[model samples]
Target: MNLKIDIDKVQYDASKRSLAKVQLNSLWGKLALNRENYDEYAIVESNEELWGYLYDKSFEVKDLFCGTKKALVRYKTVKEYNSKISRGVNVVIAA
Candidate 1:
């Protein structure tokens, strides 16, 4: 597959080449993202929502940062509860 990043119309430009390389690397990094290492966050504004995540069996709560108006819950799905493959991840596409 041909992947190209358009750079400034200059011959042997170090800056332009560096920028293009960075762009390409970032693209690859995003495409090969590890969903298992990614954490899902939610801003809970109600007591009900906060308690829901705390008691949720489908998710493993990692951290809880509480604020006055809203709270942030950082969590990930329980492996046992979510054994299915993620929709955003595809081994063929990543390959």
Candidate 2:
């Protein structure tokens, strides 16, 4: 699947100072760059490490963990006290 990622909306946690949030609407569309059978994988890291990963890879997916309500609740609980704080969060892709 072709995906687009918005590098701007990605945010890090205030307490842990790690990648905490991602805005999905910023991602415009997912286009098929090429019809090649290349293995697709994602390397998850802290906000600190995200820059490095972005520099190395052409495309990456953020908020893979917080993509679901259950996952967001669990992840938010570990990161922050409020689960409601994570509402409206979304995953975006950039071309």
Candidate 3:
């Protein structure tokens, strides 16, 4: 991602902070550019779909652990949690 940023040399607002834009492609550029695209892998697609559900369904799924523990928590496979999801219930696995 060539995040080419255009920063204002001087403060652009009363907050005395430079203005930045994330420059998303549009129209023809959007069609031509592959800047934003999703992978077609099975697991990746499943994870993406799950995230979409969590966000769209308004489920607040967040955790605070460090290192390996965090990774484990982030993608932990909880049998009970899976059952809860199957029954259409919101879940937040406390770490």
For lDDT, the strongest prediction is 1
Which pairs in model 1 have colliding backbones? none
- TM-scores for all candidates: the values are 0.63, 0.19, 0.16
Computed on alpha carbons, the lDDT of every model, listed in order, comes to 0.83, 0.36, 0.33
What candidate 1 gets wrong by more than 4 Å, as runs, is 1-11, 81-95
Give lDDT: candidate 2, residue 87. 26
Q: Model 3 — which ten-residue stretch has the worst lDDT?
A: 69-78
> In model 2, what lDDT does residue 7 have?
85
Please write out the lDDT profile of model 3 over residues 6-92, one tens digit for every residue: 675644573333222223223334335432132222122344555553454333334423343222112322233334223222123
State the lDDT of candidate 2 residue by residue for 1-95, as single tens digits: 99888889777667544322223222322232222223344444455454444454444433434332222111111222343422233223233
Ranking by TM-score: 1, 2, 3
Output the number of the TM-score-best candidate.
1
Per-model C-alpha RMSD:
5.7, 23.1, 18.7
Give me candidate 3's TM-score against the actual structure: 0.16
- Clashes within 3 Å, all models in order: 0, 6, 0
